[model samples]
Target: MLKIRLKKKCKKLCHAVIAGICISGSLLTTSLLAAELGYPEKEELTFGFIKLTDMAPIAIAYEKGFFEDEGLYVTIEAQANWKVLLDGVIDGRLDGAHMLAGQPIAATIGYGTKAEIITPFSMDLNGNAITVSNEIWAQMKGNIPKQADGKPVHPIKADALKPVVEKYLDAGKPFNMGMVFPVSTHNYELRYWLAAGNIHPGFYAPHKGDTSGKINAQALLSVTPPPQMPATMEAGTIYGYCVGEPWNQQAVFKGIGVPVVTDYEIWKNNPEKVFGITKAFSEKYPNTTIRLTRALIRAAKWLDENDNANRPEAVKILSQSNYVGADREVIANSMTGTFEYEKGDKRAVPDFNVFFRYNATYPYYSDAIWYLTQMRRWGQISEDKPDSWYKDVAAKVYRPDIYMAAAQSLVADKLLLKSDFADLVDEDGYREPQKHFIDNIVYDGTAPNDYINKFKIGLKAGDKL
Candidate 1:
């Protein structure tokens, strides 16, 4: 099969064996791989992911044979947590992995681990939501406005949880919350939602060796892995949590919690996970880097094609133990176009798990800066930085140059349409000023420092701890 596929691919490349041979239906290699046209430099690869539905691109690429179509054999493994997954990539144990959008940026900036990690693909968007325990939601539900049918109004603000937080504060008890990781989109999104409602989610002053992020917080936020969120909240360890799909929906399945607000309502169409590789890896195996990205993009396109008609199948793939490993109905609860905020209160949220729509696969510079702005806002950056610094960091980590190369190749192969990437023609990386934040504050990535100052609870310019 490899021989036949290689023969077809080689015929297209004009007999450029390009360093690999079909010896007795097996692959043998010469060092001249990817020398001229498009053969991948490194073929056998392993990728890592967390147990979340947003890891769909990697799963789809493998299951749909997109990687095999590129003449690459791939392995997909689920790491225990984000840190282990990141460490695997930082070292060479794993070629690349699905990563938090902030992970690559934070690594490049020496926040946790220092590495020149870059992402050519942004995996998906708007797949996360915040859920509170049934007790907390019971208190919050009373404050929320109801519709004509007595169902709670959506895009529920954190303001309703303010009185609950105050009740805990008034009792001299800490109001604890869980986020996936300190630099995760969940962390920033939860912080953004909390701070918007005058509930201080606290700051991280790394200069003072405080990574706890709860210095002045009214609601103390901590890390609880995505899979453990429902159990953790149910155990009364944390009152609420912000995490990606299957978990938030898991709570509803268990009748333990209710999803209060989605990240879509917090910040619409926000960039979520990224496919990250070390800079050395890209430089050492340029063609391999691009090929994997192409597979991911192809998979992303299939996932969101025809207005997510493919989602039900994708959910089946995710429900497998090798993937998300959640119950099919539970995974489909959110992945199938409707999110149940509370049990039996399913609402149409078709955009809940966006894979390729809205150019979700594109590695936009503005998206990188938005995460950077959140880091600065929450004091993870610890010091003020100029807008130029933000731009430079974003460019260093978010490599659209590589993304465009993969996208263009797909266009030339006619697997994807040129119209699909019309935005790439004269693209300047930065997006227009985003105006749909839950707080009604506009986020202009071009002027990050100015955007930071507009926030009421966050660290502003020169406002160090």
Candidate 2:
């Protein structure tokens, strides 16, 4: 009887162990599913950005506690340049970054440092300008029409700078201009404005290793880091440049240059920077991606709400050395709904820097297509592609579906109202053909080939260098 009792006790112990194993398996499955559906696999994230006004989304997200609300611990760091920012995101030193709209698109297409980079959030719209040195400004003043107040009329066009460029050319000097990066929106916008005014901003023949963008050119364009723009112009390296604020405002404050035209005049409310990450990162951390996007969306809204009453505070925050590091007054000059043209000619021009309203944060496919077309026009693409190719590329680079997933999660959590975003259920991720360019060229994302063919100044269908 004792032997039989001991054997029964051993059997009961084995049964308990098996039951525990079964229960643990079920719990593990449930946790994995929960993790896959929507919980940040990694909560602590670092995002990279340049020290410019367009990096506001990343800064605002951290300052407003939006990331913390979404259960994400986020740190924003300033990168030295565009390439460094992209490299940081790719190597995982940064989870993501504030990027040019073209960076992800170009990277995906194997343009530079090939990678499948993607953006779910676009950062802001139209915070760039074409500023010229004080001497150049003096020359341009004679060409510009003066207003009743004895100051130059606002929305100063590239026309005023045309004669100045001509004078430099006639004098056998290189008419130098600065843009932030090769794949930057600033580059294309500056080129567009100059080309529209009948100036050859030059072409890039990357096929021949002439990527300096000075082929058949009237003005020679070069890269100048944004923070160094004012000093560079003062040193007479570049006569004028197109850059984002508050660097342009810095030029005004330092008395080195005067801003002649704003990007708003180049293309009204044009898409600027975007929050970029690798496609692999988004796929690996889907939940984290959505949560991060939601935090950014909230931060963007806070920036433009109430006709920008929050801008002064934002300027102060951004002025800290750890952030943009520009002077508060210099940053506030443009951040507070007023822009200075000449040194003392400050004027109210609201909507100069839009962070959220008008769906600025959404990564629309049309926005991607615009940059792609610019690439093609400038010879970075190197070959002709069909309209469908442009569309497919736009779809790959701009992931509005990912953006909507984040928006929906925010709405479900009651952190945001359903009315706060574009109608995601019906959003086709394309803007109607835009016609507000200074050249008055109509751009339709669906017919990219046709748009390319319409340009008289750029490479057209079946054209090769």
Quick one: best lDDT, which candidate? 1
TM-scores, each model vs. reference: 0.94, 0.91
Model 2 C-alpha RMSD vs. true structure (Å) is 10.4
Clashes of 2: 0
Alpha-carbon lDDT, every model:
0.90, 0.83
lDDT tens readout by residue for model 1, 22-139: 6445565633323433677887788889999999999899888898767677777889899999999999988999999999999999998899999999999999999999999989
Name the regions of candidate 2 deviating beyond 4 angstroms. Answer: 1-37, 422-424
* Candidate 2: tens digits of C-alpha lDDT, residues 1-465: 000011111112112222221232342122333343456677678888888987887777887777755556666777888898898898999889989888999999988789999999999999999999989988889888888888887667778888999999999999999999999998998888888877888788777877888877897889988998888899999999989999999988888898888988888889999999889999888888888898899888889988898898899988987778899999999988988888888888798999988788899999999999999998888899988898899999999998888787777666678888745568788888888888789888888888888876877877777
Q: In model 1, which runs have C-alpha deviations exceeding 4 angstroms?
A: 1-36
Pick by TM-score: which candidate is best?
A: 1
The alpha-carbon lDDT assigned to residue 125 of candidate 1 equals 90
Model 1, position 135, has a per-residue lDDT of 95
- Candidate 1 TM-score to native: 0.94
